[model samples]
Target: MAVIKAEAYGHGMLRVAESLAPRVDALAVSCLDEAAALREAGHHQPILALQGFKDERDLRAASQLDVAVTVHEDSQLRLLAATRLHRPVRVWLKLDTGMGRLGFAPSRAAELVAALTSDPNVTAVPGLMTHLACADAPERPENAAQLARFEAATRHLPGERSLANSAAILALPDAHADWVRPGIMLYGGSPLADQSAAGLGLRPVMTLSTRLIAIHALAPGEAVGYGATWRSERPTRVGVAAIGYADGYPRHAPNGTPVLVRGQRVPLIGRVSMDMITLDLTDLETVQVGDVVTLWGEGLPVDEVAAAARTISYDLLCRVHDRVQVVTG
Candidate 1:
């Protein structure tokens, strides 16, 4: 399943779903609303709501939409066991192997599986699934441990099983049970902290570019941007680019974070403001107003920018606001 939750990690969910419909066997979303949006947009592929329904109303809507749901907790299970829908709803029994977030206890897997398989409202035997907490860190024991627990719990279960996430898809082949959930990888972000996307042979699918609107020649003592956080150490040419936190550029990005100007890397020299950022263009003498500046993507990796900002690539990608115009190629 191609996990395109959170608007495909802010890369535009509907478009991504449209593009992946012919390629993937199924799609996964965080909730019913996302699945409903895809259905309304005319997509007929299978969609799994990862968070499942909150109440009977949501369960009824899921049934109406023919959306599969994750039965992770007792409340959802209770609701599913008691409600009688017009049609059976496909269910995936999520086991809490080690993720600690969602899922029922692994020890109850046998009881739940038996109950779900016999339940009149359930479409078929419930598919067993689990979330891995440390798939990105291959050296961590949690991945193997989770896989072991999952296998021990559902080794003889009838329905299909799903365990691998984006990180596991790249790192743990053993965890790729029956369905592999690819989220960040589908958007071209590296799931491993120690690896780069390019190194992992994953090219960025989105590029965020802005234009340099103004330039300034600053003297040694002149300070730049809000709070005067950065000052010129010598003769400096500062290029002001038209993007900032309001547009989803990290405000916490410190001086020296790289920005691409004319495809050349230059250090961001001051505090990232609400509307713009200042870049040190002292070496790029030919840079001028209206020159293209890449915030992150293509020549500049979002991971690098995210690292300098002390966050993850996921945060940077999802935080991109509506103000930023999206141009798909």
Candidate 2:
């Protein structure tokens, strides 16, 4: 089962999910509303609510829709216990396993499982699951440590288990249980610093692009952008792109970070403002307005872009603004 949570990591949940529907056994989402939207869109795939029910009404609705709830908290368990649904609710028990986020403690996991299983309203306990904390850094011993802890917590449980997220699915063979939840890899982002999804045969799913709105010829002393952060050392041609921080483009991209224009690499020249970024296009002639400028994807890797921006590809990919039309190819 693959979880299309958070708008499929900000890469159009519906499009991503629909593309993967044939291969995925089921879909997992963050809440009931997302599940309902998918259902309305003619997606009949089993939807697992990762956060579980928000209230009694949500529990009833989930029961009616056959959405499985991830029992992550005691309050949710209680809510499930109190709901008078016509059918039993299926659930996945979450084990904390050192993430310190959701899920019950290792020692307490069995008890919670027993509690949920014993309830008449609960129909089935399909699996035990945990999120990897450091699977991206394969050399880090913490991955093994977390796996050991998870194993210990789930050893006596009879149901199937899910411990491999995208990183674990690619790197940790032992961590691959009955099911795998891959996120970043599906969008062509590298989960490991040393490896890219392309090396593992995955394609990038989103390509952020815009047009070059203007070109400027500048003298040596001429500056570009709001802060005048970059000045030409010699005669230069600057290309202004119709994208900026407002469109979730990273504002922290320092001067000289690469931006692709007409298959040529142009270094950014100045501060990225709310609506624009200036790039040094001096050597590249034949530039004009309406030329395609890719922010990241294809020739430019999002990971490299994020590195230049001093952030992660996940943030950059997910933060794209509403003004930018998202087209899935």
lDDT of 1: 0.92
Q: Compared with the true structure, what per-residue lDDT tens digits does model 1 show for residues 1-329?
A: 99999999989999999899999999999999998999999999899999999999989989999999999888887898888898999999999999999999989999999988888889878888999999989779988899889888887778899998988999888988789999988877899979999999998998999999999899998999999999988999989999999999999999999999999999998899999999999999598999999988898889899999999999999999998998988
- Runs in model 1 lying further than 4 Å from the true structure: none
Write model 2 residue lDDT over 58-170, tens digit each, in one string.
Answer: 89888888888888788987787777898988888888887889988888877877887789888766478888888888778888888899889878877878888778888
Q: What is the C-alpha lDDT of each candidate?
A: 0.92, 0.85
Candidate 1, residue 318: how far the Cα is off, in Å:
0.4
The alpha-carbon lDDT assigned to residue 11 of candidate 1 equals 94
What's the true lDDT of residue 257 in model 2?
83
Question: lDDT score, residue 289, model 2?
Answer: 85
lDDT minimum window of 10 residues, candidate 2: 196-205
Residue-pair clashes per prediction, in order, are 0, 0
